[model samples]
Target: VALADLGRLPVTFATVDPVALIRNAVWANSRRAKAQSVSVEPGQLPSTTVLVKWDGARIEQLFTALIESSLRYTPAGGRIAL
Candidate 1:
């Protein structure tokens, strides 16, 4: 599952916007939160471009997995922060 989640990437790296990326990923999983009765919260991260040259999808998967992991360990009404 981890391998599939981090499926592919280009041979070359590119600058990435982590906030936007995580926002989209969280949005995509919003229904999961409702179903699990847990909240995945994001802090007030700045708009300052926190750029990084890395596997964007992998990084997103890493965070997404962390959130999901929290759901498993946390109580039904618990919260996971990013």
Candidate 2:
């Protein structure tokens, strides 16, 4: 997922390129369904911020959960991102 801290608060938001996010999610999910492969599509990050307000702790927690889940199911040659 794409991450940005636009609000200047301690918080950072999870902001993905909408089109890339959808494509990546679909590709990752499909791979998991078949060969048990996992991969995260590379994010096309913007030079400027996209999302504004978010909780730092929440974002960390979100990534933690995601990584944990991916580790549990993803096999060799699979990929995940922060």
Candidate 3:
């Protein structure tokens, strides 16, 4: 659902920290992950602020979708480190 409007819209990219984006995405889904007995956490990320030219919102959306998808197949008590 998140990428449904991709091509039709102009993607606005800016300097952003992808690790922070992933962290926020994981935080947003923490409740759902807990309800499903799944653990979602951030994986090894740069200690320093790593900025890349990309669409932060889209990156977050992509991570959210990926985590949600993993939640579907990941067994209960399983861990997912993004």
**Model 1 stretches with alpha carbons more than 4 Å out:** 1-12
The weakest ten consecutive residues by lDDT in model 1 span: 3-12
Residues 1-82, model 2: lDDT tens digits: 2344455445446554444443444454544434555555434655554543454456445545565577577786677653
- Give, for candidate 3, the lowest lDDT window spanning 10 residues: 1-10
All models: lDDT? 0.76, 0.51, 0.90
What's every prediction's RMSD, in angstroms?
3.8, 10.2, 2.3
Q: How does candidate 3 score on lDDT?
A: 0.90
Tell me which of candidates 1 and 3 scores higher on lDDT. Answer: 3
Ranking by TM-score: 3, 1, 2
Evaluated with lDDT, which candidate comes out highest?
A: 3
Task: Compare the candidates by TM-score and give the number of the best one.
Answer: 3
* Sort by lDDT, top down from the best: 3, 1, 2
- Model 1 lDDT per residue over 12-76, tens place: 46788888778866776678987999887776778686788867777787788877777788888
* Backbone atom clashes (below 3 Å) for every candidate: 0, 0, 0
Count of clashing pairs, candidate 2: 0
Per residue, candidate 3 scores C-alpha lDDT tens digits across 1-82 of 4455565655789999887898999999999999999999998887887689999998898999999999999999999999
